[model samples]
Target chain A: MVADTASYHRIVLDSRPAGRPTADNFRLEEVAVPTLEDGEVLVRNHYLSIDPYMLGRMSTGVSYAPSQPLGEVMIGEAVGEIVQSRNKEFPVGDHVVGQLGWQEMALSDGQALRRVDIGAAPMSAHLGVLGMTGVTAWYGMTQICSPVAGSTVVVSAAAGAVGGVAVQLAKAKGCRVVGIAGGSRKCKYVMESLGADACVDYKKHADSAALGRAVGSHAPDGVDAYFDNVNGWMLDGVLPLMNRFGRIALCGMISRYGDTPMQLSAHSYLLISRLRAEGFIVWDHLDLWPQALQELTDLLQSGSLRSGESIAEGIEAAPAACIGLLSGENLGKQLVKLN
Target chain B: MVADTASYHRIVLDSRPAGRPTADNFRLEEVAVPTLEDGEVLVRNHYLSIDPYMLGRMSTGVSYAPSQPLGEVMIGEAVGEIVQSRNKEFPVGDHVVGQLGWQEMALSDGQALRRVDIGAAPMSAHLGVLGMTGVTAWYGMTQICSPVAGSTVVVSAAAGAVGGVAVQLAKAKGCRVVGIAGGSRKCKYVMESLGADACVDYKKHADSAALGRAVGSHAPDGVDAYFDNVNGWMLDGVLPLMNRFGRIALCGMISRYGDTPMQLSAHSYLLISRLRAEGFIVWDHLDLWPQALQELTDLLQSGSLRSGESIAEGIEAAPAACIGLLSGENLGKQLVKLN
Candidate 1:
């Protein structure tokens, strides 16, 4: 009798982790598919996006978005096909992307969800290069840093979703690109695939000074623009090596997410270098998305810019995929494929 | 005898201090006035500007400019009459301001000196309000922060030379100005004299959170613009209360000057708020000085703006004045007046 019941699988927050996340922090279970209310659309998620920013939502703190409550459906974005719709704007069989959580079936009020053209790019691309990740890289690079040709540009976590796109965008602008990534494998991919001029293996370097020297060796003049994702030792390294009037776009600070607040002694250096450091969220600049998405979509289609995805199958694998992504095991954009 | 000889008094950096400086760090001695070379001018300084930046010159470190070598004449700016001139650019009896160092008489090559009109303001005003100090505050306010009318503006070390002028400028722009000063006396002067809307006594608040809460109470809507002079606890306090898209002009880090560098934990808050924090030195923006100084002069002459000075007589008193200035004992612009 139970096997005949209509149900779907979903992952929810089991408990907040002490520091780095583990599989025990998430719980997967089967629940009956809820009836779609008026003006709601039911979607069967095909792909789920697992990003570094989600780590911030898992913990209790003052973040850009509110923290995810305990024992709730894990907050995330997904690409899916609408199975049923009561809203005129979204009909059945329409492919879409929205913040639908880590669930196989999701009910949306049609406000947050947006129709995606499957012909534009792969369905998974909507959650990666052609979506928020690509838009973040574009806005942070073009709007904030605005690197000029011939200038040296540095990006931390350069093999990750946003950083991967940032390094490519900087390269397209003819700026000499340098990427900092953990381990030699990611560093190599950042250099050879991402077209960065140099790669600094942060894991090999014990301290920021060592990283700074390595960065200096590649960028003899100094980094003219910086896309900062890892804000701890990487930031300290870049501060000393930044050129006069350098611009820094703070995209993410994954390194400091689990650690105690650390003091930055680079204030004097910031003054001496006359640097501009700014922090931004993509949601704040959504107006620029349509134009940015068009460009990113073109690049992805034309093979001018490439997007790599490390995908895990099934909803149960999302937790491990996210953990692996944070630990630098994932090559590029981390995603979970669910049908 | 040495006293009867035709000599001028000058202070030199005898040794670099580990932390807080002592009188022994400076040696004030009588030296024969050097003959002016081609294109050189000899000036008898009437007022020598003593500022917080001099501490950076006294220490061996990386700064905007090269560090001042030990046992050398302490470098600084002064306003005095060009008593003798060999260069056509700087005529005799012309009042001028230049990097003439801490001395009664100085020789300049005319390249670094600029003529100052005494009728524009007082002679000492050339070394204070109408000089680099005023120019700094103006550029930091107008260029970096650019607070709009009716917005809340906060300045740390609010009664000091740069911050005092910044508060007044923000007030002139019709902004709600809040000042953070060391003591009740300076706080009172900042509020009543400088036309600031509020003054917080940072000395009374033991920690950053308390100061932040106090600032929050005054600026319930939250701080819109911050001109940061002291960069330790005060910066910690202001970072939390800053509103979305807040702008911070980093003028000086006086709090971190003598202490070991500490980590800043608010990078997360910065990302959430999407703030722009920039550090600059006025020397880099001399192109804007003429317009800024003219505006500052007009304000001072019209009594729309006020300037305060803490005069320490004689070149021998310069070291103690600097020490007192660093310790937050001096009320306003710390100047060594030589008659």
Candidate 2:
């Protein structure tokens, strides 16, 4: 059932950006498909995930993982179907999700690849809520934030992929969830769709002090936990509003993924309120992925957890999609649909 | 056994400092000592502990505890001899330690008071190594830092009261300890007296970047745990040097206690390294004090734990001593010997 295509298009890292990334940073190249060896399979990519963390991998700086090598396939997660398989475990026509990069096709040895059930959810959902982003939300929220019933939880980037799921999970735990997003439109989605008790539009505030006042008005009782996605000024704004013994789950610092020098002035609140601020990457907690995915799938099927997507058509749109994602231009999960 | 003196001198808060505290902010007034009631005792304070945490209480801003009430006795911990008592628990001439404030004499109802064994250690030791400062160090090191054998542990303000004990405790655990202090003298004390593997003098470095380089040269393998006492530039300097899954026990932020807007630009290192930074107040962990004190007392008596004190002449010198402590002028525990 394999298609007779000789070559596939893939995006490679052309140059590292000095500040914010641009289209010039990526170069799309057409390469011949390799013959599958024994125990290997060829996958036809369906959806490629465009995440903020990819920016960290692109920069030649210290990140949780090593920087993505220049002149190589841009690193990312993807959901695709096995069109040609030499491995019995991954049979032809089976859908799988793994680190498949920004390509139309990927050859894998079945290692680190999870067989996704397309009957339960859409193929693209495997690149989003039912995949790594969802697991990220679960780990940071359940393990780090750990909000209890009636406790107030504040989520930065609350309309983005991980933050959106985190907001829902905290709300499901019977918490008073307050969301901070860039625009009023996303803030509305955070409140209405994600079931957050209140949402603060950070764009409306001039500085962290002003944003803090807006957050304080909504969370009259101080915040018990903070699920931080965009760290910088958002972290500064929420820290002072945290109650004594509050927790801060540092999931991502999307605000500082570029070369921007983000200043954190309200860190003193960490001692003043006796707070616990812990940073974590989802990849480190791989042992919990199975349990996290099970609960997330149940929530999704039960109509409790909801997610939105902003799809950029074709592999060529991957670079601009990522740039848009960093600027908070996307509503939720930003994905590139491959043809 | 009570002395015939009818009146005693005490220092009270005259005004809250806009920035760093001054002598004018305190008022020395003579007041008549109160007669003992049914469950009361009169204590003549011998040594008053001048801690950095008192600055937080003196500020009008939010702190771990309530701000010190103005025009009242300055909040502090004191070691003294009970001159007279109506309670059976605290007899006359028994040496004790409690929150006796900045005064030559204190009247207590036997609440929150602990009797000290002067035979084990000196009377002033009750105000330093064997008292709240020691307990604070114990809780932060054991509960938060929790460094294992062969780990590289870094302690900021390593020559100070709590940091000195923390340095020794980590050393006892068979870990390589690196200390950060103000000058060459304190750095020498950290290495020779506290038994640290290496000590970095932060005063020699112009900026955090320079200090980080000095620390990196000493701890080439990267820091596993950091017991932070001074949390402004010192914390920024050390954060980038932390290994994966490192723990930072935020014991104090003496640098930011005054009117200083500390800008932490290296906070992204928290997410990059997946670090856990937790702030704690020793008062919350009172349940663990008995266990901590038992271990500390054993270590002290066994000569495993060592501490130094810079004692001022009398209660009149308490204000200057505190000011000096904040500036990193005090070599170790700053205390005022009250007469």
Candidate 3:
């Protein structure tokens, strides 16, 4: 018999933000956990993934994914153990990762749930490096950027999750990798820890011209490939520095997730330099996930890939963690720990 | 013997313009045509191709091609008959097309010259439908856009050279084509003459939003591919209307070829819709030209392809013709008759 009286804490979207989101937009509440039906599993979420893309879902806008519905559990990915199950494939005591939302307890019907091997890495790593974040970096680097050996490749937001992995992936391909990040500390981490040949501190630059000069000095041969995470002024700075027939993999636009429309002025360079800029979401290419995961796992096991995480203590910290990530306050993959 | 004292009238770049080019930027000069060198051939020009790309060469700004130097023969393409030949490859009376410049007579060493089949089409057609204009259309359509049979395709500047051919090419591929042109007259020609399913008159729409609505009405299913010839506000209007994974062939940016940089605000749609925007110059892909020309020739012979021309008489009219073409005063391929 299931214990239907067990209580749990979950976060819900209280209201949509006008511009940048705040902690007030989310509400934490306690509710009784529902008993699982046949073929359903009750999961006790231990780690919640806080991503830059979550900001897109918070607004009622036309995006790749539908906006998060108001007054519902805030949508996100999480890694947890199956506490109770009637499903044959997933049993109690098995670790799995899924879109379990911002809650300590979740009900799953086995769809979109992947059982994780606990022996492979820590449970929280499954929500960051071994999950969607690593896969996104792999897809953009291998599929879109495809930088040739000895060529110059640049990654924006280089200290962050996807950017950190992308920087290493480019370097592994024997490319001269340059990174762009906010502040000197993140820039140092990108160069020293992520193995980027050089890193540009975007905060130090007065304008796009100054930032472009900094990037140009680091990538003197001209950028052949750019993995873009910030697409506003950051993109503006690198566009004019691209060589003929360059490629730009549009991964994310954290800077433009706000209400104000981003103004771009370097479009003329696209034609003049014969550039190709393509945008993509990792979820759209699920077929290649297995292969990407295998390669990423190999890199991790071999110690070729290194990642950093900034963890917030409980379910209550999810909103603040998300806000910190958007403002570049987090150094790496930002996550919330909930036991 | 080669004529030593034959005088020819040619146009030269007198000065670069601060913004849009005027007739005053060009100076008509009469100079004696020198005797050909050992490997050179003299050609009597028939037609001088007036293309929008010339405006880019007129300025000192970085572009695909080097800036048109001041006090030199105005750079252009022309179809002509070899009048005197020292090179056996190009005999007298042989019709050829080359970068013969804005001059009555030109000398060539046969490096970039291509022989034209004058018997198949008019000599001037080699500079329009059968040449770079048609080849450019083929490349952007077949290579970049690659619209599926039932997909919705959009072409900007649909009454002009490249756009006109691109519209017909998309039609041949069995796509539902929509054209965006400046005036109602051009819009009518785009629909009636070029066989576009619908035409949107950008002039009627006061802003990008209104223009986007007009385009949306014609393409209810959403645009799958866009052939962008005018890349400023025109691109802005069409970008948000694109469906997921839509392709944009960045052929030219006529509106932003002036001094002022074009400001774009719809870049977020690129990432949101997972779009791929690629820029190309036909000259860079010379390897595909032969195949493209062959297909174009077959289409012309089958009466499946039709093109329009706005001809200005004599080399003296090139400057005004170029100015008129840039201002959207021309109907189709703007050319100057030299003989």
lDDT of 1 by residue, B1-339 (tens): 124326988899999988878998889878998887888899988988989988787788777888888988999899899887899988998999999998888888888888899987889988888899899999999998899999999999999999999999999899999999988999999999899999999888988889998888889789999999987677878998889999999899888777776556565567778999999999999899989988998889888888888899888888999899889887778898885
Error of 2 at A271 (Å): 0.5
Displacement of the residue B252 alpha carbon in candidate 1, Å:
0.8
Give per-candidate clash totals.
7, 0, 0
| After superposition, candidate 1 runs with Cα above 4 Å error | A1-6, B1-6
Candidate 2 lDDT over residue span A1-339, tens digit each? 124499899999999987789999999999999999999999999999999988888888777888999999999999999999999999999999999999999999999899999999999888888999999999999999999999999999999999999999998899999999988899999998889999999999999999999999999899999999988988999999999999999999877867576989999888878899999988899899889999999999998888678999998899999999988899889999886
Deviation (Å) of B201 in candidate 1? 2.1
Which regions of candidate 2 are displaced past 4 Å?
Answer: A1-4, B1-4
Provide the clash count, candidate 3: 0
Question: What ranking of all candidate models by lDDT puts the best one first?
Answer: 3, 2, 1
lDDT comparison, 1 vs 3, better candidate: 3
Q: Which is the leading candidate under lDDT?
A: 3
Off by over 4 Å in 3: A1-5, B1-5
Q: On residues B202-254, what C-alpha lDDT tens digit does candidate 2 reach at each position?
A: 88999989999999899979999999998888899999999999999999987
All candidates: DockQ: 0.68, 0.79, 0.85
